[model samples]
Target: MIRIMERIALDDDELHEDFMRSSGAGGQNVNKVETAVQLRFDVRGSPNLPEGVRGRLERLAGRRLTKDGVLVLTAQRFRTQERNRADALERLVEMVREAAVPPPPPRRPTRPTLGSKKRRLEGKRIRGDVKAMRGRVEGD
Candidate 1:
């Protein structure tokens, strides 16, 4: 089981891992060994995740989320299969952690203060005066 938050814990069975050949570096080893790890988790189907977190996670997953609501994470940073697998799982945990936090309250709409409105008008008038001064001077 993985603990996402104080109240949220994900079952070990929730994660699915597949191995594939890694690209770049490792030369011959890269060609022969499957070092990359693909980790998948069902965001919508997971009973461990709260509805709020699930929705947030789905949005956060973006392109990583499939039509079936599975979140896919690929790890190929490390050359070893074990390290790549751990990296994938770590990324999944981090993503879930981000989703667990509650969103900030919506900002309240506020009207400009009377002083501020007056100041804005004053600035505009000053700018207009500056422009007016640049116009052709009348016979003085």
Candidate 2:
């Protein structure tokens, strides 16, 4: 099981990994070896995640989240399959850990202070005056 937080733990079966040939650098090894790791996690169907965390994970996944609600992460930075696999898993854990945190409270709407509003208007007027002075002098 992978521990995301004190309350959240994911089973190993929750994660699915696939190996494919990695692109770039390695030359002959790149052509012959399947080093890239693709990690897929079912955010919607997972029994391990809380409903709120699941929703946040889905949002955080963004384009990585598929239409079927699977979060797909590909790791190809490393040359070895083991490193790439570990990288993918580590990324998944980080993502889940992020989702575990509660969102901040919604901000309350606030009106501009009278002093600030006056200052803003004053600044605008000053800017207009400066721009007006830049125009060609009518009597020059």
Candidate 3:
């Protein structure tokens, strides 16, 4: 099981991995060896995810998510297959971990305090005075 948080954990069977040729920096190995890892997770079908978390995960997945609700993550930063695979898995875990957290409560609308309103008006008055002084001098 892949633990996202204390309560949220995903079974290993939920994840599907595919190996493909990696682009850049591997010389001939890049063409021959399938070092890149593609990790896919079914967000919509998973029983492990809560409804809130599922929705959040789908949003977080963005373009990586397919119409079928599978999240695809590609990892080719590392040259070795093992590192790339681990990287893909780590990315998935991080994404799910982020989704597991609850969103903050909506901010309540607040009116300016009387003291702040007075201060703002005072500053505006002072600015107007400064601007008035800059007008054409009568003695000039």
Candidate 4:
């Protein structure tokens, strides 16, 4: 099981990984060995994820998720396949963990504090005075 949040765990089968030749930096080995990793998770069809969590994941996935609801992560920063694979999993875990939390509740309307009201009125008065100063001088 893949641990996301404290109570949330994703099944191993829900994730798919593929490896391909990594480009740049490693020279000959980079050309021969498959060091890049691609990880895909089907957020919509997964039985491991709850409906609410899946919905949140879809919204949070942004460009990583495909139209069919597959979340794809590519890891090519590392030279080795194992390290790249680990990096991919870490990213997936972080994304799901972030998706697990609900957004904060909206704030309720409240009356301004007495001090705040006074400060606002003072600011308005100052602005008014500045504007009044710009008016044409009387009889001049």
- Which residue window of length 10 is worst by lDDT in model 4? 45-54
| Cα-based lDDT at residue 88, candidate 2 | 96
lDDT of 4 by residue, 1-140 (tens): 98888778988889999999988799899989999999999999888777777888899999999999999999999899999999999999998888888888999999989999999999999999999899778894
> What is candidate 3's lDDT per residue for 7-26, written digit by digit as tens?
89999999999999999998
- In candidate 3, the residue pairs with backbone N, CA or C atoms under 3 Å apart (3 or more residues apart, or in different chains) clash, namely none
lDDT (10s digit) by residue, model 2, range 1-140? 88878998999998999999999899899999999999999999999989999999999999999999999999999999999999999999999999889989999999999999999999999999999899776885
Cα deviation of 30, candidate 3, in Å:
1.4
Model 3, residue 44: C-alpha shift (Å): 0.9
lDDT of 3: 0.94
Off by over 4 Å in 4: 113-115, 119-140
lDDT of 3 at 128: 97
Name model 3 segments beyond 4 Å from true. Answer: 130-140
Q: Look at candidate 4 and tell me the lDDT of residue 95.
A: 87
- Give the whole-model CA lDDT for all candidates, comma-separated: 0.94, 0.94, 0.94, 0.91
